[model samples]
Target: MAFAAACAAVLAAGTAPASAQAEPALTYIWPVHGTIVDHFRPPAHEYGPGNRGLEFATQPGSSFWAAARGVVSFAGPVGGRLHVTVSHPDGLRVSYSGVAGIGVKRGERVHQGQLLGTTADRLHVGVRRGEVYLDPVLIFDGDASTGVRPPLSRPRLVPASTSVYRLQLRWLHSGAGIAVL
Candidate 1:
């Protein structure tokens, strides 16, 4: 019947072939272990005076890391202060300012927790999704008070055979009382 065919089509569209499925969203970690000295404060207008990112109070020469796996988009001085920026796969650009010792270079691929540079007395971290700046506190998954990000969670993988069987079982149990084609 058309109704059954429509239902089957809808169900089929819900589950893509495993190879076509997207990977899980990337989880971000803290770039450095330090106490948060300042939080994000959005400006009233463009070029207005307001802190666009989080500031951490850390010891000079303390190592900082990439928040997530990404390519180094920039590593150089900005306004006389050293800075490093990583462009993530999710289109996020994370910038670390006030760094003293640089380790990664521009266009280089970096993994999560990989050392990018060392910070000075304070570290300024900024995140941007395109041109709009985002708060780093909300991006990283961890406790801001402890200044440590926990390990990333492992994704559960389901075998193709078992997944298909489970989907068929679900369809049958839905009271349609019809076997999937």
Candidate 2:
């Protein structure tokens, strides 16, 4: 009787369905082809202690790719740079800022590594999971193995739903804010 009960229990646990035990892990690709100069630092600028993001120091007109597949939520000018943000279905958001111009629009679907925009020395990039913003460096898997040690550490993530912060950008080229949404 004991052996039968143990076997039943194991079967029940294993057959419950894999979806219930799955955790969503959203990963993004490198937004631009430039080397990472400035990483996501919450306190590096005037955004106070919890504004996390990265700045890609690249040349002007370099293509910016979608880090992951997502839906474009907000695409416009902020801090004098062309910015585009894609909200994934898994509750993660990826942002591309400091670009020369945007190729995606609000409410459009974007694939992984899709052409979203172009970056420059002034381009800023970021990723957020739920209300918590993560260090952009943590998502890059090849950096440490490739002998490129990132200077940033994993921050104690805080709720980012209310933290609608902005980066004070230095533009690479002048442009106006135009949108489809």
Candidate 3:
């Protein structure tokens, strides 16, 4: 009976709280230090008009860095605006638009805090997982002293699916030339 009780105790010890066994949280930083001119506003529908990212008002020539390590999935002009996108290992894709210059190229691996490029008057940073766009403010770590506040809620992660393939095709048709990383 004592041996059986010991076995049960061991089994119970293995079942820890979910938080104790959870995966390490991904750490992200701001791409650029500036005032948030525009906040993320999810569209009513996928194709509806809305601000899908955060817009920072910084000096026109100020340089922006990669928020996290990832591969340069797309770097070029999109709808007349210069953009650079990094596909993070965590399955998150971060796109920096309104760049005045391009420092990285497609398929190039970039480290966190690496120089991405310079922005024009403002920089637009977007984050996505699969087909669902996430709020950049939630993913990034912001300090109140810098005028950036911590995220009020957790981000919802959607699994990657065929929608990702459709997104690539859409970009291709739009002449963005964004290939899978």
lDDT of each: 0.84, 0.68, 0.83
Per-residue lDDT over 16-86 for candidate 1, one digit per residue giving the tens place of the 0 to 100 score: 99989897778687788788889899899989999999999999998899888999999999889999999
| Number of the top lDDT candidate | 1
Q: For every candidate structure, what is the RMSD over all alpha carbons to the true structure, in angstroms? A: 16.7, 14.2, 15.8
Show how many residue pairs clash in every candidate, following the order shown: 0, 3, 0
Q: Report clash pairs, candidate 3.
A: none
Winner on lDDT (1 vs 3): 1
Model 3, poorest ten-residue lDDT window? 152-161
lDDT per residue as tens, model 2, 18-77: 667765565545666666667666664455674477776788887777777789999988
Error of 1 at 162 (Å): 39
Candidate 3, residue 130: CA error in Å?
0.5
TM-score: which is higher, 1 or 3?
1
Error of 2 at 152 (Å): 13
Which predicted model would earn the best TM-score?
1
Q: Which residue pairs collide, candidate 2?
A: 29-67, 40-53, 131-160
